[model samples]
Target: MIGLLATVPALIAGIRALRDRVLEVAASGATVVAGVGLLAVVLLVIVPSFEILPKSARDAERYEQQQRLDELDDIDAGFGPGSAEEAGQEMQEYVDDALQLLEVAPRTMRTTTWSKSGTTAAGNTCRAFHERIRLGDQVDRSSSAERLRTAWKAESDHTSFFERNGVLELSVHPAAATISWIRADNQLIVESDCIPYAAP
Candidate 1:
């Protein structure tokens, strides 16, 4: 009977050891499954970002380009010469500077003119002279506008004053500048000093 009792204790210890080993294996297997699941979740999130990265980069590039264009538009509005002759001279000077900046000669440069009738506070007749400077395909209008704006900002102190018929207008004391983007021709139309011509 004493020998039987000793054997029973050994049997209990052996059973306990087996139970502990089984529990350890189950815990290890659960941990492995959970780790694999976490890895899968991470991949699911990461893979889409990789696919979207290029598109996000493209969007950022486009936004920057648009910002540059808008800034150029604002800058274009600030240039104006006091008279028709001065307007012509100033336009040529601007074109020359723009060509230097762009490193390209315009295929063609042309000007058009018209007269608008206006009434003054007094009974005198007033005429507003409008001039449009058109540059040809050799000059990229958008780039030229940007360069011209930079040059104008450096040379003059002015700010955006108004908008009329989709054209942006700016004033510098006795002179005014009108800037418009011609989408169909991919050109820029700059009307300078479109105010009543006053004789000195």
Candidate 2:
């Protein structure tokens, strides 16, 4: 459209130059109008198609991620309250299964504990088991982060998980699981806990 519009002055100049030759003037004017009209029609069709393409691609990718997360959720739903060692084992298995499903390897996988002084959803002083997985150099950080965000959003529509200050959090029910993710440079760090404190 901009290109077509830019040619208007040139078209007017050509028309002015051929004003004495009525036939030529009419032909030139008609040609200019027809060209611009064609371009407008093409832009109308092409521009909207390009606009919708990226959104459709993102939606399809999100659907695939959601399906994978649903499978993971099915596995997670079976877990019951247990000792720290048992919860750690279950969280490890969850991470392993997720890695397998995602076809990505972690640079480092370790266990840690998150402690809080306040009472939790479980009616106890805060103590949670965490399994941290760090993506290796082999992974594409941006793409992985997008996929993880999509999966987390699909699992639960909670808006807090999408906040962009720094950390992203995911909480699962029944099992009291919580997952926190932070992206650093070219790596994505994921912390998962089967035994999580209540939201505070």
Give the TM-score of each candidate: 0.38, 0.39
lDDT of 2 at 82: 42
Clash count for candidate 2 is 0
State in Å the error of residue 179, model 1: 5.5
lDDT tens string, model 1, 1-200? Answer: 34334444544554555567756555555545555554555566556768798899999888866665554343355434434445545455444554466565444656677656654443223345455656667776667556655655565554444444433233334344444445346444555543333334
Per-residue CA lDDT of candidate 2, range 86-148, in tens?
A: 545544544554466456744443334443234333333334455556555666656666666
lDDT of 1 at 186: 42
Number of the top-ranking candidate, with TM-score as the measure: 2
Among all windows of 10 consecutive residues in model 1, the one with the lowest summed lDDT is 166-175
Q: Give the C-alpha miss distance for residue 97 in model 1, angstroms.
A: 3.9
Assess candidate 2 and give its lDDT. 0.53
Local error of candidate 1 at residue 153 (angstroms) = 2.5
Candidate 2: where are CA atoms >4 Å away?
1-80, 106-126, 156-162, 185-200
Candidate 1, residue 200: how far the Cα is off, in Å: 16
